[model samples]
Target: MRRTHPANMFVCECITQSLFRLMKRKPYNKITVTDLVQEAGVSRNSFYRNYQSTEEIIRQFLEEKTSKWWSEFIAYPDRYPHVISEMFYHFLDMKEEIDLLYRAGLSHLLMEHIVLCGRQSLTGELKGQLQRHQLMKQNVTEDDSYEICY
Candidate 1:
């Protein structure tokens, strides 16, 4: 998610909460500003004040969620070896949200985020491994390490 002012947290949360409710009731293409503001118990001006458009809200939400998954993965560095499988489990846990993103035609965004984070995690892991293994370090240059990881 983009950097939002602390004061606007309430506004964004309200908008997001309302969006989730509405999404459960209808398709993304069918939702509107009126439905948003009404469900959130806020005014149209409030909705417009925080988000440029409905799609922006969903994108920001997904970005935040994607960041969260990466943080969870990174927090346990030892899990890097099992990152792909663990991420698959995490995706299964978030099946509802993933389904919603897919239905909204934003599955590409999720895929891009996962790939970006996964690559970073693997890079970090490989560097750590090479640093800890003196014999491996003597044999493997950084480029070779990357190639091996890839």
Candidate 2:
């Protein structure tokens, strides 16, 4: 949405880049809105205009990354030799942020996000493998779906 307004986008982008840099250097709780605005070269109101809180920013960042992974995977569904392996590597690249989330006690949610992305972005070959391995239940349900993805 911010991208629609070039000036607002600059504000949003500056805030995002600054926050990520700060996050790498400090715990999320330790960072403040003032710190964000200062580091982002924007006013406190500018930060609030874009995000309700730092956690919201982090969530948005993760959501954007997951969306990106899905986009890339869908664009080349048959490109990967092993779908799950590709998923593993994709998450592997986020190790630092994942570790930070783990330390902040949000790993479980992130794990579920990753798994959901994995299940949704499954390639046709992977689906066939799941069917061949009988991962799917006769009456498919969320638990059965988890089994297939897991």
Candidate 3:
């Protein structure tokens, strides 16, 4: 039988849950993949297979949680402003993990991912709104400022 990806049920959950619990008690830097694996009763290979590094895990965890909120935000555009506010608050709440990942040399990657996600989401929403207003034309010239404004 083929072994399942550790991320599906065992290793990733263990690592993430352990990290979440430990993060409340101490700084992220103090925690290690070994600690997580030990706490979660897994092996180093399992951790490695699921995550190249601890920073990757941290980024994935943050992204996963944020994606849920993002989905909810998109579902209710009237609460979009509140969603943005909550997003910032969530960032603040994860400051320790963010700081740890940054210190571990993953700051640039994490920031890029965050910015890319935000830009993609915004662009998608704008395109949807334009289409909804019937303002999006199939044959728009690049020189047209009307399309640019939209």
Candidate 4:
């Protein structure tokens, strides 16, 4: 088994929270690793142990957030549409951090992951819609076609 680095684990959580907070306030590029470590209350060495650079930390954060959103959406399919809207609101809410990540050139990877997840979610929703449509078609009474068409 591989041993986990304690410094990395600590720094990771700190950076995640700090970035989350920062995203709520300002653009991402405006923030620095120095700021991150200071806000996280961790030493520079601790931050370095887990991440070679701030961009790496941001990338990891984006990946984790995207995965979390995906899990939540899957868990409650009935709320998927609302979840998507919430995700958009989240991005708008975090515009500052997102801008910083984009300036750092890490947004591409993050956006790609998000887009892939969105595609998967959309495909799943479409499939469900098609199945429901098929069921409704099969159960249609003669008068139902006129009602549906009208």
Best by TM-score: 2
My TM-score estimates for the predictions, one after another, are: 0.66, 0.69, 0.59, 0.50
Least well predicted 10-residue stretch by lDDT in candidate 1 = 141-150
| lDDT (Cα, tens digit) per residue for candidate 1, span 1-150 | 234777577778888889878888899889989999999888887787778988778767766766777765445545444545666776687688778878878788677666555455446554465335321233444345232231
- Which one wins on lDDT? 2
Q: Which ranking of candidates, highest TM-score first?
A: 2, 1, 3, 4
True lDDT of residue 11, candidate 2: 83
lDDT of 4 by residue, 109-141 (tens): 667666655455434454354234432233333
- Winner on TM-score between 1 and 2 is 2
Model 4 residue 34 CA deviation in Å:
6.0
- Whole-model alpha-carbon lDDT for candidate 2: 0.69
**In candidate 4, residue 83 scores what lDDT?**
47
Q: Per-prediction count of colliding residue pairs?
A: 0, 0, 0, 4
Model 1 stretches with alpha carbons more than 4 Å out: 1-7, 119-150
Please report how far candidate 1 places residue 1 from its true position, in Å: 15
Quote the positional error of residue 72 for candidate 3 in Å.
Answer: 0.7
lDDT of 3: 0.62
**Model 4 ranges off by over 4 Å:** 1-10, 16-40, 82-86, 102-106, 119-150
Error of 4 at 94 (Å): 2.2
Candidate 2 lDDT over residue span 24-119, tens digit each: 788877988899999988998888777888776766667767777766655554555455677678878878878878887767768667666656
